[model samples]
Target: MTIAMPVLRPKSPHFSSGPCAKRPGWSPKKLNTSVLGRSHRSKEGKARLKLAIDLTREVLQVPADYLIGIVPASDTGAVEMAMWSMLGERGVDILAWESFGEGWANDALKQLKLDDVRVIDAPYGRLPKLKQVDGVARDVIFTWNGTTSGVRVPNADFIAADRQGVVICDATSAAFAQALDWPKLDVVTYSWQKVLGGEAAHGMLILSPRAVKRLETYKPSWPLPKIFRLTSGGKLIAGIFQGETINTPSMLAVEDYIDALEWAKGIGGLPALMKRADGNLRVLNRWVTATPWVEFLAVDKKTRSNTSVCLTISDQAVVALGAEGQAAFAKAMVARLEKEGVAFDIGHYRDAPPGLRIWCGATVQSRDLKALTPWLDWAFALTRAEFCKVAA
Candidate 1:
């Protein structure tokens, strides 16, 4: 059956995973107030940077003892910094379920070369047995949300409050969209470009007092790059948390982040942001439940991600395409949607199984998602018809 083209369309069809859709009323003029053309070390530049940090803390409701710093590279750099600075002192445990989580595991095994390391990984669609980690004494590193696979840790219940080691989380896709169990996480990293839809390249690193202590005391066996360095001599660098960035920062990006933070505050704060993301998932959930051709990549509904909502094409026709043909079908469907200008960057991550990955972050309006769902159905129907005819 041919599905007719839907005339109603999403007001904004900018759903790329990383550099996601900007806020509802975002404009270039938002950065006009940016303190540009000044040394980041200058008072004004530092003020902007500090404002970004403070606003992040306020919006996220981070613990008073937790420190937030603007790191050089995106979330990766912040995670690596924590791993390098603290892992060798204790045995390590790495948990992975998707591409980014697996990347961190590889870093621990290959790059850092930590000997006392244990890796527990699950297939893309499922989460690892988090219960196995309840009382482990090793430093633990994992992603709060598996952006590529659309799986997320359901909660922080698996982490013991009195554990000896630290928990480092790459929460780039989860920070604003989901609440963090601050008491359970020792180090948390994210980028502005994710949930808040700000610029890329700048990473936010949040550390509990324990993590800061680890940095101030433990020195890595490997050489520390200037950008990764978080401490000076033997003392924690107080300036990094105070907006003295390790290297020059794009003041423009900082300003944009501040604007996004202000927007988050305006619309109620963390709870409202989480509600928006959850509302997006609710919209997609309704579509997916009604659409027999598509299903969530995440096996468990409880662990399914609300932000990076990934879906697999499950129609018998597409499934018969086999892996290679399914990949091609997904690519074609994505291309069709882009050509129609109804969606962009809806393709799955390169490493994940062939499917669609839609960004349902806070910055994305629910009405856009509501409008986009029917288009997805329309595109999938047309693509399936074309592929079936070719096969026949």
Candidate 2:
């Protein structure tokens, strides 16, 4: 069963989930270079940073009162800052359905050592019981989109409107590509490297009034690192939210982010960004619907992520080969596609179930995904044939 190699290939084959594909028609020459080689504390430098924040607020349509800050260490840093700064005051409900969510739960239970932490979790391709989350009294932590698992919460309806405690959402993979319910989330974190595909090392942290109030009033029992500190003199540091970062940021990365933000605004803001992502997903969806040998990892269609679209081999022969064999087969297919230069970095996350994880974020063009699917089929058919021959 030899299948011909795909003749037409994706023009740009970068499908990695993080540091995703750049916005259409992006170029280094297009970035504003004046911000580079100047002190981040300089008036001009601060203004550029402020512009990024302002554009984020404008494009994301975040509520007027919620505070958006640029933080260090990408989305992980932003999440850590929120967890370390404000979780001691009340019991916490941490939900896990994927690697990143599990990491947060481990930090709360193991590192933070919170005595009253409850972990509600589900396996890969599924979501935890959102009904068990007590946002009314206990703080809740969850990832709105599980990048590794390719599962996402359908909506924020489960969160109570009158929640007394805060809800922290790690939305690194959701922002721009998906609509975020700002009122339901008290703390939201994302990185430049995700949906908009800007350079890495910087994170965006959005705090609700409730989260700011917690920061101002509640002090954690553990010692706070200088980088993690978000308060001073029992008052929220307003400068942090206004673009004065906690630490020195990469000015070049800042410019790249601003460039992406500008590109986002030029293309009709949030709605257009989400529509692009939806279009990319539809490309994959139609292929998956027609192709019988592959299936989406996300069990439920409603929970499937349009950003990090994960897939698994569904042929009974491949499934019967056991986990290790499936992993090898999938890896071979990924390698084939990469070698052919039709796709790259489509392999599943290391800890996730062995499969393929193709990034279908807003930055990725739908045409590229359409071209890549035929390559996917070619790679799979050829790899399966090799495996069968080896078995024979």
Q: What is the Å distance of residue 347 in model 2 from its true position? A: 0.4
lDDT string for model 1 (1-392, tens) is 44678999988999889899998899978664646888889888888888888999999899888999999888888888888888888887888899988898898889988888888899989999997773458789889999899999989888888988989989999999998899999999999999999999989899999888888888888998888888888999999999998988898888899999999999999999999999999999998999899999999999999899999999898999898888999999999999989899999999999899999999999999989988888788788878877422
Each model's lDDT comes to: 0.90, 0.92
> Which candidate wins on TM-score?
2
Once superposed on the true structure, which residue ranges of model 1 sit more than 4 Å away at CA?
A: 32-34, 390-392
Candidate 1 has its poorest 10 consecutive residues by lDDT at: 383-392
Candidate 2 structure quality by residue, lDDT tens digits, 1-392: 34577788899999999889988898999989997899999999999999999999999999999999999999999999999999989899999999999999999989999999999999999998888888788899999999999999999987888998999999999999898988899999999999999988899999999999999999999999999999999999999998799899999999999999999999899999999999999999999999999999999999999999999899878888899999999999999888888888999999999899999998999999999998888888788778756331
How close is every model to the real structure, measured as TM-score? 0.98, 0.98
RMSD of each: 1.4, 1.2
